[model samples]
Target chain A: MRRPMPVLAAGQVHEVHGEGDDRAAGLAFALGLGTANRQGAVLVVRGALRQGLGLYGEGLARLGIDPARLLLVEARDAAALLRAGLEGARCPGLALVLLESEGPLKGYDLTASRRFVLAAERTQTPLVLLRHAARPQPSAAHTRWQVASAPSLPLEAPPGAQVRPPGLPMIAVEALRWRGGPAGQTWHLQWDEQHGGFRDTTGSLGGTPNRNENARTAPSGAVLPMAALRTG
Target chain B: MAVERDAARHGLAPGMTLADARARCPDLATLPHDPAADAALLTHLAKAMHALTPSVTPDPPDGLLLDISGCAHFFGSEAKMVAKATEITGLSTIHALAGNPAAARALARHGTPAQRRAEDVAALPVSALDLGEAATTALRRAGLKRLGDLVTRPAPTLAARFGEGLVLRLRQVMGDVAAPLAPQPVQAPIRAEARFAEPIARTDDVLEVAEDLLRQVAAQMEQRRLGGRHFALTLHRSDGARRRLLVETGQPTRDPPLVVRLLRERIDSLADPIDPGFGFDAITLSVKRADPLDARQTGLDQSEETQDSLQALIDRLGVRLGQDAVLRLAPADRHMPEAAQVSLPAAELNSSVSFHLPAMPRPLLLFDPPQGIEVIAGVPDGPPLRLRWRGAVHEVIHAEGPERIAPEWWRQRGGHMGEGATRTTRDYYRIEDARGRRLWVFRRGLYDGMENAPSWYVHGLFP
Candidate 1:
């Protein structure tokens, strides 16, 4: 196991403990959140459709940052995603290219994927990849994350209403790897309904390994939270 | 005696024995009196005889007997009819008329075929009565010599005493009993023959004449409510040369337009060097086999949908591709695929059009013989796992059950094959490849049944 290093993407939520500089410092140490070491670059946010991107955007705005700094690119196919990456660097002020990887199965062979890795290296444009296959992909991706959402607590128990309830559920983002950041970390946060935003959590939800219930369900002793884990 | 000199030189004098005559003149040619040859000659001559009524009988060894009783009045009188027959034979032969066979034999043998008066017969000896030598000798000894003398006797006693031969001979010449000469049968082949007014060297000229003749046959067929399937076109040249072309329809049809089309197609290939002579003046159309056309069906509008006549297609295709190039497939008896069809050219396919055979599953792609295939399978009698067909390997994903089609056993026991040729035991299978390519293949023989080894062959591709 490695130390936890936490980073906030444009569409993510990070929690702080207590209040003032001490609380902020404790939260920063615990989450490993700090200013990025590199210049203008890509910031990949890993999760599923179950964990809404709207909630993550609210957390970044809480840090008094403008959402316009990130470029959201929904690339459906591999060719479209690859093109979008190179085009992001050409924009000069662009920092990130967000690609949604879902719908239908298509794969890039080892040779084709190596070319994408080399292209990213030559242009010095960091690349991010998301996968939705049943098994954990062993690939040339820099890091992997097991992300999912937590169950929503009740606000008002409606009468015969089947709509989505309030109090946006918490997302359990498991940092499976990190090329530049400290790895083997997990975080849980809830979207704040008062300010119509998401906020960082204050308490640790099992900081160490607990394998009996969660590990029995999680693959490789790592569980993500965005939607209920359905094993195939 | 030019007659005696010619007959003597030709070795045919009456008293000159044919053998003795052949010995005196070493080059003298003699033939056994061939009644068959004589009959064949009469048969051909009968074609020319059609100009004078259809009745003409070959008089066995020497002459022709025609029942021209009613026919004689048409040529004015007996003398003129005799003169006409003489003219037709070119006056080199003889003709006769009498009241009986005995009398006619006396007149025709002694007199020329040109002379019809009884006086020409009067000078002939009593031996010319065609009676036996004994009867003639008895008549001569009794001093009752001529037919004129026999006429004075009581007719009943003459009949009671003379044999049936003498009675029959007497009755034939007297015209008491008709000889009933066989009418020369004109075969009248299903042909359209036209002799041109001017010798036609051009193809167009022949086609024009053919069109007219076809129309005539078409009208005749319409009257009889019949349709002809086979027709021959004969072109008579002025030099007595003949060029004939035959065409047949897939279905019986008497349409002039179709006949004209077939003829035009045939005439298109006729070369110019086959020159028509000075001119032709006669044309004829004859039917070979007439099929009754149902008036009920043909009365509908002339559209392809209205009738199921194969003639319309045969005519259209036969014109472009030669008649032989178009063929109709007729099922024949045999297990071998090659023997399964009697592939007759469209023209020859018409006459023997009806065929009967039991229903069976027939292959659409029937190779003369099947091609061998290389296959790697799970086992013998098991479905193929990988088939190397047409220089490529196709992996099988799924296979259907075998549909066993047995060979027809009885039909194969003839011709050049002695015995070693074994019958095929086919087990057909439907197999699908991994890439979704479906194929129909069969195993030739069972694993241990009878063969060098079991073999697999791809027969067809299934969609």
Candidate 2:
């Protein structure tokens, strides 16, 4: 007998079809299992750059996580990224799966994307993709966003400063479509090298406000307190 | 005086001195006597008596006791046994055996000093019974010089007179109390002797002699269902020269061909300037140790992939150089690198290695320990970045971790070696070189200022 598929908390399934619009940056706050607060899996695109990943690692670090997990792939192209990302299914202890690549991704087939969506839902590892804006996105992505931004400030400066170090990156994210959130969530986050993640005190007024009340208590002073961050 | 000493040759009187004997025989010569030499020769006879049994204990380098109950069968009869004793004693020493030790001792000192019987011993004087001088004097005063007079004496009267042991000795001689002499069980040694019609002269001839000896050796072992692990091959040169070659094998084997082959390699190389003068009269091959060959029963498809090939290689190397040059890594109860292994005869080593372990991971490449390597790094905690090992600089390209393994503490403590070398804590790191060579090195001891912690050594290399 086929077992009944489990119901997502109160049936919060989006069943999103295709990329509808990116006008207000479709913003959504997913209050599910954050990578830090609990044990889970997440998927990110290869070469998603600092914008999407910076916020992701920050949100994870903020959750006072039990143990955070990420499945990483350093692949040559989109096809290679997909192949590598699929290997994550073999890890029984897989918590969060992230896929990153820097190659052109403007021409992916939507028909295959639908299958990727179903596989993600079945495996329970929510897929996060960081692809080029020109790439034809698969119609299967539950939520689509054009992630772009900059660091809030340099290690020695506050936000909106030009004196930032050369290697430090910035991220500006706008959700193209969010199932449960406004389409225009934008957060200004700076990368904390010591924490090995990104942080944004600017609030998730537009996109996902994933951090709970406990995260806001972390000290964020003029000098980026490099504590509370670790990477393997 | 000399004239009278010469006349004594005709018939000398009882009270005579040496000056009178010289007067009677001025031409007669006398030599100083040696009683010790006689006693020593008697001792050697007792040793040769060991042919009878290992229990041939000498009664103070003179007397010999044989428990001949079982020994008599070897000579056919008691009369034959006495004949054998007579043959062995020849013209050298007096020998006798009776039911009792006192009877035997008395018969040995007198009564032709060669052979005697129980009834003839019964007719000897009462002194022949080994009575004390005082007792014999007392017996003579009573006019009882011969043992025949006391043969029918009243038992109570003799007991009251002679006080126990004399009566007991007489009774034991008559088979009253059993006098048991425990014989040492002599192991009939498994032996193989080859009598060469022609003594081996050339070194190669020794090989043939070894082959012949091996056949006899294997047959002896097969009869006993035993296998020899150690064998000594002896070449009896016609010139009375003896050269021995010792051959040892791993498993107990009775394969004559392999045994001959192994002994041949060693024997053929000997630099013996042997002369087949009259040709060696004998070549002996003897096994010193043997065990029952409990070989695993082979299945239908099973074959004895005997380690003969490896053994053959070892023998070849051993012949060219020496036995000490060959070594087999044997497990030993030690953590010290030098003591970690025992080099024993490959054939004699135990197959199963045992260790009492703290279970610290041992390195794959262990030097005779290692000369301490000077390291410059974040001390007390971090892995070394620059290591000076074997007088060469190696920059640690990448490091995985610090697997901290403490020293075995149950053993006696060694001196403070900072962190670890002999008995200090070891913070081991699996470090790789920029050239892709990996090393397992440890930082000795805590680098705390409390004591000395200046040593670091590269213990092993991991591929």
Candidate 2 C-alpha lDDT tens digits along B273-328 = 44556566677888988989754555553123323433443444344335553344
DockQ scores of the candidates: 0.01, 0.01
Q: Residues B1-463, candidate 1, lDDT per residue (tens digit)?
A: 1124465455456656656776777666555666677677666665566667666666656577666657877889988887777777653666667654445655777554444564444445556657878987877887876655665677787777665666566555555666555555654445555655456666676667777888888777777778887787766666677766667666677777767776665565445544556644454556666888855554454343312333443454454445553444455655543454455565454443333322322222233345567888776776677888758787765565466655554544653242423336678765655443445578876676555777888764321
Candidate 2 chain A, which ten residues in sequence have the lowest lDDT sum?
Answer: A18-27
Name the weakest run of 10 consecutive residues (lDDT summed) in model 2 chain B: B356-365
| C-alpha root-mean-square deviation, candidate 2 | 26.1
State how far residue A218 of model 2 sits from its true place (Å): 50
State which candidate has the highest TM-score: 2
* Model 2: per-residue Cα lDDT over A1-232, one tens digit each: 1111111121111221112111001111121212323244333324423221121222222222211222223343455456445434222233444443333453345655555555555546544443433443446555554443222222343244322222222334444556555444443343443453444434332332332222222212322322342333
The lowest-lDDT stretch of 10 consecutive residues in candidate 1 chain A is: A16-25
What TM-score would each prediction reach against the true structure?
A: 0.37, 0.41
- How close to the true structure is residue B355 of candidate 2, measured as C-alpha lDDT? 32
Interface RMSD of each: 34.1, 23.0
